[model samples]
Structures are given as structure tokens and as C-alpha cells.
Target: MSADEGTTPSPLKPARPSMTAAMRSSSFLNDHQQYRPPSKPDNHYGIDTVVEDLQASSINSPKQISPFNGIPSPENPPTIVESGLSHEYTHPNCTQPPGLTTDRLIATLFYKSTSPRVSNAVGPSSSPPHTASSPVRASSPTGADAEIPSNLAPSSSFDTFPLEPPTNDTEPLDHIYGSYVSPMCITSFLHLMSTFPLPRGSTNLTSAHRCLKLDAASDHHPQVVELTLAPAPSQDYLSLADLRKHELIYRFEREWNIDVVLRSDTLWRRHPRLVVFDMDSTLITQEVIDLLAATIKDPPDLAARVADITHRAMSGELEFDGAFRARVKLLTGLSADIFNQLRPVLDVTNGVRPLLRALKKLGVKTAVLSGGFLPLTSWLAGELGIDYAHANEVVIDEATGRLTGEVKGRIVGKERKQELLLEIAQKEGIDLEQVVAVGDGANDLLMMESAGLGVAWNAKPMVQMEASARLNGESLLDLLYLFGFTDEEVAILSKET
Candidate 1:
């Protein structure tokens, strides 16, 4: 080509020297020396070039980016700065990918970018380097809402493109509930998202209300981020079939201790009207029946026997009512005065008072359904200002003012708990789907199942697996986060007490 043809470009170089020859050389130029002529400047950029540049950087730099892309591949890896994001995660037991170089990883990230943004740039490496003035592509959906007319396209950053929110019909809204996802993990998450094409994110960071908008710096809890995930092209919705996306989700959870719950955009789910808690281990740390039996000093081993039965019932070993009734029989002659001693020392579970107070301030109805005696449950309801309280009534022999060794009313067993949940929801004029149940035992399973959301709080493994959600966190306040309240909102509500 002549100087007169300067406006046009020269023939491009071959894809590369063979992998064998390229692998033999350390620097990119060692094998592909002819591609960049010594006589000229060039701007030809491709995924392979991106790969080579990152590869060379990895080889020469002291720290490798690591296989999991700095999800802290080991117990405590250093913060990795790549592509303008600086975040580090320490997933102490997260499984790492097989050994892969940065080059291959970049290759994995862009292998799907077969569009003109990639193929059209394959001219001579002898052209001017990429610049702000160079014609660039915008990665947004092209349609009637296109900001730039097709005739006047301009260069834009990938960050300039906003990920579109999921429509009600196509992709449902969901949440990733974990304390681990930070701004830096955005890159890894984006990479995982890119593995399956996602709708673009927002360019309006200034005023944008992310699905979860938290001021992490000021928030005591890790900020909740609203995530909108969709099925990739040609893929069936995961609700109907197995989802490969969950693989990445579970991986992140395993490594970073995150729990991704796919919640709907419905109002009832995020802001339920009623929340029922089991009194024994859920609302309080101790089992009331076991405590009641412990006060029977005459039979030194009665508490031990009652506790064993209570444990078995909670673990689902024995029938709930049978075990409960047998335990009451052990409490046979204990004086009614025992209730006075247990009341003052009743230990509320950590985060219970604050959570109940917050819920009350928000006007969410709260209830305590217990298989234990009604007196303690009612006292708890009064103390916490809960709306409803239901429990078995201990039959006391009025003549002697001593225990009758039986319950007077209907047993508040698992089945009864379920019935009461629906009954209360109806009485409150709330929908059945607008109630939440929290418990820590097998008997609570049916009641939990009946509610829209069931949280197994520090429960047995079976309850954890079967419940709609589980809260193994240190406090119950995190539930408010799942409901989409921010730090300020939570603080304001939790202070009502």
C-alpha cells in the first residue's frame, strides 16, 4: 500500500504463531514480532491481545490473580486489583477452580464476545493505539429507547451501560442475603454473570436505588444488595429445571458464607403482615417445660428425664404431644410457685426483643405459639408487646394449688400450631401468604410450612434443610434486612423499645 492509501489499513497478521511456537516464547513479541512493524504506531486490539497483555502482566507481576479470581482462593489472600476494582474475599473453605493462568481466565471471560466489537478490530497492529477519540461501541440494547442514534454512535465505558432491571414477566426479583458480598466481589460476580449473559446494569449510580441500597460503610450489617438475575438465552427458567447459575451462587456461598434467596417482587413477601415465633427455643433460649421440671427438687433426676424427652421431641424422635404430656406427668406435684421463679430469669434469645420491637413499630403482627404452658407464653407476649399468644394451659388443682399433671385445653402441638397460624392470619385480615413463621424444632415444621416464609433459627439440620429460609446468623435483626429495610430504617425501628 502507498502513502496515498493512508486513510485505509494494511493487511492484518495471522491469528497468531501456532500455540506451540507462542508457548515457547515468554514475551508476546518474541513469537509475533512481525505483527507490530517497527515503522508504525498501531491500535489493533482483540481478546487475544487482552489475553496476552494480562498474561504477561501475571507472569511478570509478583502476585497471580488466582483461579477463583481473588475470591481469596486461600484462607486469606491479598486484595487483588484488576480492571479497576479493588475487593478481596476470604472464603476459608471455598473450593478453587483447577489451576488456570490469567490469560486463560481472560479468555474465558471474553470467549463469548464474537460480535463486531471484537471481530471488526482485527486490522494491522501498526495503526494508532486505542484512544478516547477512536470509534467505540456501546454495550446497550439497541431499540426505540436508544440514547444515541445509529448514525451518530460514540465511545462509551462498559460502566456507562446500566443493567436493565428484570421485567415482571421474564425475570423475577430475588435477593442474595450474605455479609460477604462487597464492592470488589462485583467483578467476580459480573464475571459469573457474564458466563451467562445478563441484562445490562445501570449507568445512573448517583440516584439509582439498587434492589438493595445499603450504606455499607455506616451500616452495622453488611449492606443488602438487590440482585436481578435472568435466564440466559435459550435456557429454561431454573424454577422448572436445574440451574447452572446456582452453581456459581452455591460456590460463592460456600466460600464467602452468602445465602442467595430468590424472593419475588411481591409486597407481601418483603413486608409480611404477620410473623409467628415458637416460644421455647426460638423466642427464648430455654425450654419452659424442661425448666419447670428442673424445679422439682424432690426427684433429683426428673429434670434430666424431662430434658431428654424434650430433646427427643424437638429432634423429631418421638411424637410431640406424647413426649410433652409425659414430661408434664413428670412435673406432677410441683407447686404453681415455680412460675414465679422462672419468670424473672427468662432469657430472651439474642436479637428477639429488638426484632419484635422493630416489627411492632412497623405494625407487623407478631405471635408466640408454644407447646409449653400458657402462663409463660402470655407473660412473654405481654413483655414484648406481641399481638398474639397461644400455648397449652397447665391444669392446676384449685383445692391444693398444685399441678394436675395434665393440660386443660387443646394441645398446641405441631398440627395445632398450623391451625392457629391460619386462624390468626384470618383474624388479622391478612393473607395467608403474608405471614412468617420462625422456629427451631421438628414440631414447628408444619406451622412453618403453612406460612409464606419459614425461618429455622439455629435449628437442627433437618429443619434447616426443609425450611424456606434459615437464619444461622448471630442475630434475628438480619431478617429485617431480608425485608429490604436499610441501616437507617432498621436503626429507627429497633429503637422503639
Candidate 2:
């Protein structure tokens, strides 16, 4: 091909050394080579520059670029950037085959190019890269765009994303209830959230509303405030499930001795028709069965045995029915006179009177559903003006004035408790959703599930897991606050009474 004669370009050929091989050599030099002060900026450009230069020079003299081409083999492998994106080195001998455009060649050389704008997207080694020019992906079905910061996406190092308010207007609403021990000042609650944010949504930060205080004396027993938080951009709506999944919420609960309730506050205000309470630990401080067994002839030994059985039953380790029968047998021949003696020790839990009074004011029915005997439950219900009582009966021998060691009625285990809840709900002419059940033992779980809203009051682990809301702090009156009532409203109602 003489210079004077018009010569056609030789058909393009694949480079002698693969692009990957060239990239590896370049990376090796960059990593291991000592920097003797550079005379010019390295440009820090990677594989693409070499490829373009090679293609350009290949148009003139292809043979001269071969010596520089290094085939990447087992002895010399490609350097993989930890970010999962692979970069390749280029050689002038590496000329694209005929008909392949530069974009097509780059697309083939790299595994597969998604979009041209992706080149502007940064990999681990690339700095000051711009975001893809393309519009962001559409918002999710939840109307929240989970846009991960470009800096965070490549390396995969992140604990959480900072939540912003959702720009969209159609998201469902949610509220977070933060409750603590009495006299919980509004400022204290705010400080707690600022210190350890559980909900991390604008709704929680901006829409906080003080709910009714459970202990009417806010000056002394101010317990809680309800904050109606708005959804964050990443999360269109929050739920109890969302709160539980966050580690900060659990930490907030443990650290502050606070109980958090995330729910639709509106629905709970409808007022429960029947608020069924577990007689043992929930309504009263002691387990009636354990208390009864403590009065046995061998007080220490028999009480220990009965207490062990009671613990197992409440913890859900042993079946309540079998444990109940076994416990009653242990109390065989125990004097019935002990009931009178034990009556004084039957401490009605704190806030019972006020909670009961409030329920009565609202014309809401109340009941005591117990696995314990009627002797105590019936008496307590009557004491508190409870509308109904359902419990096992301990047969008393008139002649001896002692327990006959037998239960005369059906045993009220978990199933019976649930059945009684349904019975009470049906009798009240209300739907199941119009009932509230509070209990602390495993037996109370089914009844809790049966009710519209279940309150686990200082409950066992299992009950806590299953219940709708949990109260770790004291005061059954906390129920009113949970119902979205304010201290002023409760005070007015108390005055009306």
C-alpha cells in the first residue's frame, strides 16, 4: 500500500492482550509503585482512557501497540475494585471490530452498560461523580422513594437512612404514644425523643400532641403524652410493627421505663363495651392461687410448691388446666377461714378505682374473668362495682369450714377466658372490636386476642409479644390515656361523677 495510492484501512482485530489484562497491570502499578513527586496530575483516569487512546493510535500503527499489551492469565489476574464494579486497562493494539460503535464497544468491554448516564455514576475508585442524568425511579407503591445517597450505595456501609417528610399527599396517617411513670413532664418526653429518636419521622417530631394524663393529678402523677407523628419520605406510614422493628424503640423502652404505643388513635376512642381484666396479677397484685396456697398447713413448703406451679402456668411452661388441678389438690383441706384471713392481703392493684370509675362514667361495662376461684374474684368485682364476674368455684365444706379440694365449676383456662370474653361481648350487644382485655399471664393471651385492644399489664414475655399494647409502668388508669382522653377530660368526667 503506497502512500501515493489510496489505501483501504486494514480490517480491525481484537487486541493481543485482553482489556482486562491491561487494567490489572495498570492497577498493580498504581497500588505498588512508590509515588516519586508527580510532574503532572495522574488524571487518575482508569480503564476507559486507555481504551480510547489505544483505539485512536490503532487507526495509525496497530503493530507498535502489541508489545505494550499484557495478556491477563492465572499468573497475573485483574485487580477487582471492592465495590463490585470492574475496571479494565486498554492497549492501542486492542482495536474494535468493524461496525461496532464506541458506545457499543464500551458496553461489550464492560459486562453490560445499563445507560449512558451510568458512566457519570461513581464506582468506588471514581471521585466527584455526578448522579445519573436520568430521572429517579418512580416512587414505590407506598408512595415513598427510598433514595439511597450515592455515597452510601456503592460501598454498602449504612446503619439507617435519615427520614424526611413524604412529599406526596396521599399517605395514611399514624401516631406514636410515649408513656412513662407518673409526672412525666412534656419537656422530659421531648428530651427523651430528641436523645434517642424511635420513630424518626416528621410526624413524630412535628405533630406531637399531649394526650390525657392517666393519673388525674398531673401536678403529681402526670404519666404520658400522645404524639401524632406524620409519615417520613422513606416510610409513607408507620405502624406498631414498624416501631418494634426499630432497635431504638426497644432501647427507648428499656432506658426510659417508658411504653410506646403506635396505633390508629381514632379507632380506640370508640370506647370498649366490656373491659375484661385478668383477676390475678392484672387487677390485683398477687396470684390468687398462690395466695391461697400460702395459707396451707405447711405454709413454707406447700406455698413453695404451689408458687412453682403457678409460675410455670403463668409463664406458659405448664398447661394451666393441669396446673390448676394440681395446685387445688395441694390446697386440700386448707381451712376456708383462711379466705377471710387472706382477704385483707388481696391488694387491689393501684389505679383500679379511678379506672373503674372512669369506665362507669362512660357507661362501659366491666367484668373480672379469672382462672382463680370465685371467692376472691367475686369479692373483688363486688368491691370495685364490676358489672360481672366469671371464675372457678372452690367448694367449701360447711362442717369443717375447709376447702373440699375440688373445683365445682368449669376451669377457666386460656380457652375459657377467651370464651368468657366473647360471652361478655355478645351479652353487651357489641362487636368483638368493642372490647378491651387486660391481663399479665399466658392464660390471658387468647382473651386478649379475642378483644379489640389487648393491654398487657406487666405481662410475661409471651403475653407482651402477643398483646396490642403493653404497660410496663404502673397504673391501670393508663388505659384512659391510651384511649386518647386528656387529663382535662378525665377531670371533667370525675366532676360529673
Candidate 3:
């Protein structure tokens, strides 16, 4: 059989009308379609239109072609049925043309909708299915195949690709997956996902958990970590609450100390010379008059009078002279011998010895400017090796050997304290800058202000607010450092004392 002779006669099938044939046969085309020699093919089809037409033809063509088999009949032309009934079918191995796979279709649609160039780089695999053994299967109409579990099936391929889990072994205890399923898988997923570049460094569950942990541990939140020690311009100017918040734990010689802050270097470098101390509640723990009164007859009444005067004088409410005079008049005719009897009961302030001893060795002259009487001040000066003592002298009549209800010298009021400081400075050839004053009373304000450095020692509120420095938590020995004394210097001073 020759090729032409062996060919079967074409079947004489009934004509089925085509829209193109009908349109061409009409009056419109009869006039327009007169055969003219075709001009050079007009390049009128747009690039996009040509591409789409080529894609459509390719998609409709059979997968295999053979010359021995005549042109395929329309009924038998390789049928390209979608994997599922709907266009949204997903079944592995189902036949489809190139670029019609679910992934490609999704990507193309996404690129068209968003106008972004879709990159072809493969992203992380979806999280392993809950039942790892049951593999997923998906297929496009064009025969493209993909396997993804129903649970792992992507909502859309245009969605962000999944990330592998972290491999961190030290996972949080509260992790839901870590509590139940394979920890190994969770760890591996974390490690793989970490490599993916996420928008804000969080994509997978593990990274989200890590981010939360980091936020919890931040310094902005109140955790029990040591505070950052960066220097601020003004340490002394902080609010009371802020001062307490950043309080430092310090180790001095043989002592563990906690305080809001330490004085700056400049304060100690320019150390004061003459030190003035308030006698009661500052140098000594107890008011000597109150102790003396307790030892005297009608102790309760005398103690009450002494306390009243002390409170008023300390608060800056009553003039120091008026309060002192009133308290002294109550003690008038009380024996000068009472001080000797009550001297044993007097309690010196803590660390007073080391403080005074260190000051003396430093050639820092010390003074006790007290609202307390002269006799007590003189006695304390001798005991403590203080260089100067200015206090209210109780006038005692020689005939009676009892108080005469008068102060002999200038009253040790606040103004008088300031004056005495100036007078002592002049007498000793010392500048006011060479003076260190310590006090606990409002009456001490003038004296404190007069000295170069004023220390408020467990002071009243007014004094604490106004003083150059305040020492509340540590003993008087702590003042040694404030004077630029090192630990070794303190030890040496201790030995000398």
C-alpha cells in the first residue's frame, strides 16, 4: 500500500458550523476578503497575546505524537482531565501541561495580582505531618505532581514558605510540642527555620517563643539582675525612689555596706579641715541632759522637759537659745555633780572613735559645737581628743554650788554656731574651706553651711535635705573614705586610735 493509496477516504461527516467560517462567508467578509497577495505578515499580535496563544495550544496538545496514527479524533485526543472534578483539583500523577501545575498556577496568579517578580527559589518544607507515615499527594491538570499532607497542604503557594524548626536543645519547658510529640523533630525544625530570613526574626513557633523570652529578660522590665552601672551626670539629684532602686552593695573594711550612692571624687579631693559635730544624737546617741535628768529626782518630769526642748530645737521650730534657756532653767539648782554620776550612762555614737581618730591624724581639727552644756562638751572633747568645744555654759553660783539659771557665754543658737565657726577659723588660721561640719539638728544648719563640707549624721529631715553629704547606713568610720582615706589608711588610723 502506497501512502496515498493506503489512506482511508475522508469521512463525509455532516457539517458543524464554525463561527470563523460563518463570519467569513457573510457580506462583511465577502467585500473585505477579496484575495490580494498577502502583504508581509503584519506583526499586530502583542507579545503577551502571542505567548498566551502558544501556551493554550501547548496545553491542548497530546503528550505523545506518532505519524503512523492519523490526526487524533476530537473524542480521543489525549484527554487532559483535572485530577479532581473541580478546577481546584489536587492529586499526584494526574496529567497536565507545563506551567499548569498547582504551584506554578498559584505563583503566576500571585505575580499577576501583586505585580511582583516571583522568585523560583524553593523555601522550607512544610512542618512534618502529624502522622509522618501518611504522605500527601497533589496533582495539577497539566500532570505536575506534589506531595503534601492535608494538614501540611499550603493554603496558597503564594503564601510564605514554611520554615524548619529550631534545633535548640534547651527548649522552654512550656512548649506544647516539646511536651508531647517528638522533641527531635521540633528541634530539627527550629534549626532549619532559623536559617530563613523572616521579616522580624520571628516566623516559626520556636522563634516566637525565643522572642518572648528575650523580651521578658530585658532590662527595661524589673528583673533581679544587677543594675547597669553607667554613670549619670548627677547621682545626688535622683528622686528618693530612684536612689533606693539603684543602691549599691559596697564592701568596706570589715563591713558590708548598702547605700544609695557614694560621694564623688571631687568632694573628698577637696576635703574639709575643721569638723564641727552636733553633740546630741550626732556625736553621742543619747541626749546627755535626758540621761542626766533620768538619773535626777523627779526623773519623768525632767525627761519630758528635756525632750520637748530637744524636739523643738531639732525641728527648727523654736530658737535654739529660747529652747536651751527653758531646758536649763528647769535644770537650775540641779547639782553640777549629776554630770559625773550620769557620765557612765552616756552612749557615744557608733564608729565615733575611728572617725575622730582618723580626722585627728589627718591634721583635720575637730570641734563639738553643741546646744548641749559646756561641761559635757568639754568632757567629750577631752575624751575624743577634739581640738575645739563651744557650747552653752550652765552658770553655777559659787555660794550654792548649784545652777544659777543662766548661760554664761554667747548662746549656741544657729547664728551663734555660724559665728563660733568663723571665730575658730580665724583663731586657728584656717580657711572656711578647710572645715568639715557634722550635725543632726536644724540648729546645725548655719554651722553646716559655714563649713566647707557639712555632713548630716543620721540627721533631721531639714539637715539631711541641706547638708553637703549624708551618712545614714554606715558608721562614722565610713566618713574616713569620704575624706579620701583608703582602706589601708583606715586600718592605720584604727591602730593609732
Candidate 4:
């Protein structure tokens, strides 16, 4: 089948900005350069498995919310200004029954629906779903006709507020996005909701599992939709829910071509004040060690040996410090000045500049905490204008001007990286809850866990499952949506530099 000819389009799917592998050539492009392979890879896993430093990851899903995941109702509507680069912590326009706690999920479900199963016309022209003051009764077939479980949450608990379809603006949009599943799959969603065991009982598709409050996120840019999941067991992540998410999300992604990332609501509201990155395979494309190994003249297989060790270390199969030391020992007599040759060829990951600019606009401090050696790490930090840089320092022999293959002070292993993160946060006076760390390997896990949000960027399956969140979109800028920024807001911030 042709790339664009998968499922039949729905009236609702075409208006979204998200698209498939075969993106339409933009009229705005230079006429000679308009037909390049689509910038956004198809969300389908087949072609999205791009060759990169890290292995293609295992499945990523939203962090499951536990029964204890409840928050207090706001005294007033949250006052937010998301259209600009404002760093305010306000969340606007939430109203639920007065004096009740609610479990929230800031779901960033994009418009990937493209099912052959047809539904009645629903588009930008349709009215927005009703708010809490006038919530429509839960009406999905599974909810209205399911076998009410014996241990379901009291229906009265969730009946006060009801779930509604996400809202969209009325402006007529002209662009057509690619489709994934039909909105009709909300049928499958309702079924999963009932089967997902709750703390007190089951969802049973009852009113208590209703979606209560809706966020005022931008509806035009294939937006984020925040909902207050009334009667949810807790806000904490649960193992069973995550296992089910892992087992099912992969199938749904492959069969239907959708992306579902679940994150714990633990750091949901805290916008970061500092962002840290692991340099190799994350901020930049290549592993510096592998590059060093390729330069060895005496040993023809030096590159292969070091590459094997580095891969194992990053994969969590080998202890990092031993793996790092083992690789460095192979380079006992290399000229340290090779860094100059290496520095010029390093490729920064796509979206680094725009993400940094947005963070800078928000007055966030930026850092690079790499496990590789430097002057290269420091050089990358300087090139990117990052505020702080830390990495392993190779000891140079005064007699020969070659690397002694020994580290100078302390090794920047996983534990050391965590310590550096805390030190940087303390020096900046930024609270731990306001720091974000991004990386692709096991060494990054500790620092990521300590930060307000830990983003696993095209991570290994192991890292994806452990980090605070996983990012697999076409570009890293998709990260802004995790913080509730819309695509338009991201576009504006990306234009800064």
C-alpha cells in the first residue's frame, strides 16, 4: 500500500496538525527542496527505528496513577498564560464540585485517529464538551452496558462529575494530518478502564471513573488534554497498571499507529528551573569513547572492543565505572590533542538549540553532565552556551603529551553524576522539584529520578521504563507538551534563535 493510503480518514482526524510518514510537501518550502522525506517520521514503529547511538527502545507508556494520586481543589481558577514563554506555575480554568479531592492526568493525546470504523461528524465546528457545572452523563457503550463489578467504586462518588470528549476550537483548519486509530477506539479505552483494577474497586465504567475537570490547553495544535479523573484509586503509579500499559501500548502502537506515554502525576505541576543533559548519545549523536577507539593505530580492532564495552555499559549489562576504565585503558598512548579533530565533527541532536532557547527564556539554568572525557565536554558546553559542564578529565603525561589513560580526580559514574546534579541545584538555589534531567542510558537514571522530571530521549527500553518520562517524537521539542506547552507556543519559542 502507498504510505498515505492506510486507514480511511475521519472528519475529526484531518484537521489535526499531526501527520504520517508521507507528509505533504509544503508550498512554503523552496521549490527545489520541497519533497524531502517527511521531517516527522511516521509514528508507526517500522520506519521510526532510525539508526542512532542508542538501541531502539522497548515500549513507553504513561506512568500509571495509583489510588493515592489525589490533589486538593484549587481555591480559584488557575491563572496561566501559556501562549508565551512565561514560567508561571498557574493552571487555568478548573472547576469541580467544591471541596473535593481529584486525581489528575495531564494526558497529551494527539490527533492520530484514523480508523476505518466511521462515526458521526465531529470537528472544529462542534461545541466544546460540557464542563463540571453541566457535565453530560457518561454514555459510552461499555460504561452504560458493562457488567458492574462487585467491588466497583461507589457510583455516587464519580456520578457528581462525568467524562466528556476533548474540546476543540471552532476555527476552520485547512491542514490534513495522518490518521492512526478511530475515535471509536474509545470503545477499547472504556474496556481497558473497567479491567484496570482500582484501589477500592474496579472502574466498571461507572460515573466515579468519570473525567471531571478539563484544562484550557490549546485545542488547535493537536493539543494536550488534562482531565480530573474522579474516583481514581490514587495519583501514584501502580505496577499492575504499568505492566498492562506496557503489554498493550506496544500492540496498539504497532497495529493502530498511536503513541501513548503515561507519567506519574508526582511532578505534574512543577515547571523546571534547571535542565541537565548527558552529553553522549543525548545532547550529541556519537559516543566519544567509540570515536577515540577509532583513532588507535596499533590495534586494528580497538574500535570494535571499546564499542562493545560502551554498548554494554549503556545497556546496563556492565557496571559503568569498570566499563569506562576498561575502555580508557585501551588508549594508553593516544595524543590528547586528538580532541581538536574530534570536537569539530560532533553533531548536536536535533531540537537542542530551540529547547535551550525556550529554557533560557524561562530563566532556567542549563548543564551538561557527561560521563565522557573533556576538553570536548567543556567545548560542547561552551558551544551550546550551557551554564555548567562536568565530565571525566583524562590525565595527561607531561613527558609525552599523551593520555596516561588515567582519570585526574574522580570518575563521573552514575553516582557521581547524581552528586553533581545536586551540587548544581544547590549552587543555583533551585529546589530539587524544579530540575529536569534528560539522558538515554543507565548512568542517567539516578540524576533523572532526583530531578523534577527525568526525560529518557529515544532511550533504551530499560531506561524508558525507569525514567520519569520517555520522548519518542520526531524532535525533542515535543518535550514542551509534557510541561503543558502547545505546539504554537513551542513554535514561537523555537523561533528565538
Measured by lDDT, the strongest candidate is: 4
Residue-wise lDDT of candidate 4 within 307-421, one digit each (tens)?
A: 8788668867689998998888999999988998998889888888898888888788999999998699999899888999999998889999999988888889899999999
TM per prediction: 0.56, 0.56, 0.48, 0.60
* Model 4 spans with C-alpha error above 4 angstroms: 1-93, 96-99, 110-187, 197-246, 249-255, 264-270
* Top model number, TM-score: 4
**Regions more than 4 Å wrong, model 2:** 1-206, 214-222, 231-248, 268-270, 397-401, 495-497
Our model 4 lands, by Cα RMSD against the true structure, at 33.5
On a 0 to 1 TM-score scale, where does candidate 3 land against the true structure?
Answer: 0.48
lDDT winner, 2 or 3: 2
lDDT of 3 at 81: 54
Candidates in descending lDDT order: 4, 1, 2, 3
Lowest summed lDDT across 10 adjacent residues in model 1 is found at: 103-112
**Candidate 2 lDDT by residue in tens digits, 1-497:** 67868877799888696557545664555568687433322343345446533444333323444354787864666655758877655322234346832210000000001111111122222221222421222222221233332311221112222333223221111101122232333344445444433333223333345534533332243345565543211233434446444566544444333556655433444577789899888888898888777666665699878887887688677899989999998888988777667778888887788889888989989999999988777888898999999999888899998888888878999999999889877877978878889998888999998888888887776677668777765567767766767767866655535
Measured over all alpha carbons after superposition, the RMSD of each candidate to the real structure, in angstroms, is: 29.6, 30.0, 33.9, 33.5
lDDT of 4: 0.63
